[model samples]
Target: MAKHHLDPQYLDPNYEPVVNRSGNTPFGDILAARMQRRTIMKGSVGAALAGLMGAGLAGCGSDDDDDRASSSGVASTELGFKAVPVSTENRVVVPEGYSAVAFLPWGTPITGAYPEYRPDGTNSGEDQEQQVGMHHDGMHFFPIDLKAGGNSSSEGLLVMNHEYINQNALHATGPSYVNGLRPADEVRKEIAAHGVSVVHIKRDSAGVWDLVHGSPFNRRITGNTEMDIRGPLRGYHKLVTKFSPDATETRGTLNNCSMGPTPWGTYLAAEENWHGYFANKGASQPREQVRHGVGSESRYDWELADSGADAYVRFDITPGSGSAADDYRNEANTYGFMVEIDPFNPQSKPQKRTALGRFGHEGVIFAPVREGEPVVCYSGDDSRFEYIYKFVSSQPYYAATAGGYLLDEGTLYVARFNDDGSGDWLSLDLEDPDFAAKVQAAMGTTVGDIVFEGFENQADVLLNTRLAADIAGATPMDRPEWGAIDPNTGEVYFTLTNNSQRTEDQVNAANPVANNQTGHIIRWQEAGNDHAATGFQWDIFVFAGTQGTETVVDGEAVVTLDDDNIFNSPDGLWFDYNGRLWIQTDGSDDAPYQNNMMLAANPETREIKRFFVGPTGCEVTGVVSTPDVRTLFVNIQHPAGNWPDASDPRPRDATVIVTRDDGGIIGA
Candidate 1:
């Protein structure tokens, strides 16, 4: 069989080809520097081990049934349930003591007369506007009574991103085209399924989880919803589209992947892979568009709608006989941002926090907030050889008055991992004297292939974020995906999903394997445990591969998975309040693990075990648990065969609610 390394999250096989030619030190060298061969375990991590393992292999614990202990003499992670075996069956599987039930499948109504879902995909565009969307990704559960100072687990608002759509499963007979033009209504339905959904859900007295129909807080933020633009690039010239001449607004958020919940209780929907939705058929595209891969063809072909309406025409970014404000040439620029939504307020408009910078944002993870310190958050661009970033708010966070505006003013920084297990966060703001000095000093020098011509302004730096990172000498990673912060350790963990295109010479410590078919997780500790810290120590966490398989470079020691804990493409990541790191995968089923799955890891002992396995042809992504940790919610996207309902031919993406049969704390 051929090696499958490209992430399954890519919409097209050719999408996001290796764009980073920066020749930065690969992560493999970094790991090799920190590694010291000790004992040659047959098929386990011999030398290259978890960062927490240290030089003596202290914290690396065994998850075996009879050996639930580590060399450090500390107890293994308090995972209460037995690890379930991997499965290719078309069904959701949980531990023997847990129950997995499907809830709120796509098209279940919650607003505007509660339009019922039609399995045959006959729902009209208007009907879809009031219904749930397709391909659920990142999600969060906000207690309904949160404002009242109560954490109500029984009732809460479940807000999640509808990443993208499956055209075959959406339309009755699939999409139709005549003379290369699509029906306007079909295009409208597709648009309606691309943003975020806020639904009110409740666990009744009978312990059944269901959606609350007609709840005031239940509403859909679709592709046509009018949103406010906020932060540094708010009225920038590049955002001046025909729909928003003042550049203070934009319609819709697309390709929203994983999300981030702010310390102030607002939900942040990260826009990822949004570049594929727009087609720039112009002679020459700007650096911003070219750097992010906005080419001549769109993924859905929505721009070729026969009706030629303003909304439909905007998808085609080809220059017209007019300026940026007169034509739709700048439409794509309005996307690729972090959109903040207040789930508590149904009337509040979602705001695009442009100060966070623009790129393929896989997700955002905020650090533990302090009463009078700047709010800091981290995000990663999910493309081959892209960079990871963090934003620090200029204003100190005050719980009493804090809200989404805290994200309006911030300094964005890109990371640079060094071979010595040390890394630095480079400031992307040109206004910073230090950053300005570096840009001025390197003006004539060529770093990556592009000349260091210093940015026009702070707004220009953000508009061309990827290009700015390239010029700033940030370390290009192997497809940085979902991120999670250890609630107990203050360490940040990011999934460096597979990058098959990485050549032998590109192998480095953070990403040690060339032709990286199965990816690994890399983590770092901020200086003084401060999220805003500029320097830090780093290490490789775990390398994803088959049991006993040696994923090595020149015989350098990398981790090997055992039977109980093996996975690929570690994508979605979350740390429950108790510090149990939930790791989800989004890779081809053929890679050792026959199906996409979720695993629970004890960051302390470095012990991991599979927790849940999704159906065939599906990616197990988003994850969140109720306050008491009794109920866990995991999303299964793009499942194949009959799922949730064996009799139903049309499989729908849905959230799986896992609860203990005895109603104990989940994952213990």
Candidate 2:
């Protein structure tokens, strides 16, 4: 059943690019436009606003003009793929005949008792705790395919990951605190509201997919919920805590980022920025302290002012004679694992798979499952110079299997790249000779094994995956973000977001470019398309650049294009089922590229065209599509608070849908 998602007119023939100054160049610009149209023309695949785009993304362009010269050949009535224009006022947009709907909006109820969100931000942590979580990111829709003569919602459970909370947005005036201190009341509220949200959605023959709010299946997995820790690293001394009566389970999930869907109908969500939650005493600590993995980036700043409680005082692990014995010195070890949520079972307890060694996980892209074969997942470490890891589940995945717990068992490994394009999937086993060699080499067995001996526990291995990967000698990358797996081919694509901080001297084969601020997406086709293979070939697919400027850093001329081709940072990513690669940007210091955007690209063509752009002070994040192709959902997040107070009515960041008119498909 080939379904049509967009209309032939997804981009009407009359659709004229605002500034497609093909073969045109601006004098005194950083560089001249070498814009030329080429074959396999790839274009950015997101929505755009006629107004803001004209104002904000006026000159922004792609790597080539040859890309814009041809028609997509997709007709509205036969729309194969398209980009539609929807309204954009600090919100996500889709093409005309398309619509934007808000789901899991900020302060949306997570629990049944939570109060309704009053746009003014008065919503408290009390009732809001159990409701749908905030800042929805990567999501998936599993259709409820019922046999004949059955009443089933065309829709299924909408499983989404809440990246992080917008305190100012979540609370009307930023994070609520008592005298600059996080109130336990507030912490408690946030704890209950941060994790995964599973709610049922249904669409009728008329194509309206509405949320069944009271659906018994609606559920939320918060930070306080108990999660069983599994994998090689389970039950380690480092994970044993005074809080965990049995020492194997942990209390919460935080910064849940991008996701993956199992062939067997389960949901996989990766926890990112888990490091920001701990409180480190800076680099002044001892070698043991540094070796313990505590650095300047811990979360909670709980050290500043202890509300004298776990909700506040638990973050600081300073061993300077202060009694952390009864507190959470070992608490940081609990986070940084891949959490599995069964969307079908609302009452199912979310489990953190420790076998997937932890780090700042951006996503978990699984290797397409094959019966009787090992299941593999690729993940990127978000921080600068972090490593990319892969998890080979111990058991083979069976699509028809009744049990969904297979994901809990797996052999987690990290990658170490070679200059000659060869790599190794370094395993993190305490008893392995390779592990002993690394410990002896880095820490000298005496201190190495003891300092990180807690990693001796697989829980330590899974929870502190970075450390395990470190001991395994994995290759550090240029701040890896989201990853996309090609559905047509089994190749895995991961983004190495910009890292300008690295000096030329620090450049290595893996992170080949120095001061490589504008990042690149690296694609690797597993040998035989086998994710379980220990080796794979790799290449730099698209080096990000400004629309029409050629950039030469330390001597490599990456890309040159027109004004529209210019792009600063690359972050969020999604490879639509159609093979169109959708890219979202997060420009941190590259303020010149104002109004971060989302670009649609053809992976095979490598042609990136600017499809949709965000509003003033908003980051374009969270991208997903319904199966029908009629509804396209994108999230406009953290909109404008970096500019002024959260109350400015100029625009409120929210999700919007885009559907074509005449009931035609999108981008046909």
For each candidate, the alpha-carbon lDDT, in order, equals 0.82, 0.58
Best by TM-score: 1
Model 1 C-alpha lDDT per residue in residues 28-138, reported as the tens digit of each score: 555556654444455433334433324312122233523433222323346767999989899998998899998888888879988888888899898889988989999
Against the hidden reference, what TM-scores do the models get? 0.92, 0.77
Q: What is the lDDT of residue 308 in candidate 2?
A: 67
The clash count of every prediction, one per candidate, is 12, 73
Best by lDDT: 1
RMSD of 1: 4.7
**In candidate 2, residue 445 scores what lDDT?**
40
Candidate 2, residues 380-403: lDDT per residue as tens digits? 877665778887777777656624
Candidate 2 Cα misplacement greater than 4 A, ranges? 1-101, 146-153, 175-182, 204-206, 280-313, 316-325, 402-404, 430-436, 443-459, 504-515, 549-565, 588-592, 641-653, 662-665
What TM-score does model 1 achieve against the real structure? 0.92
Model 2 residue 615 CA deviation (Å) reads 2.3
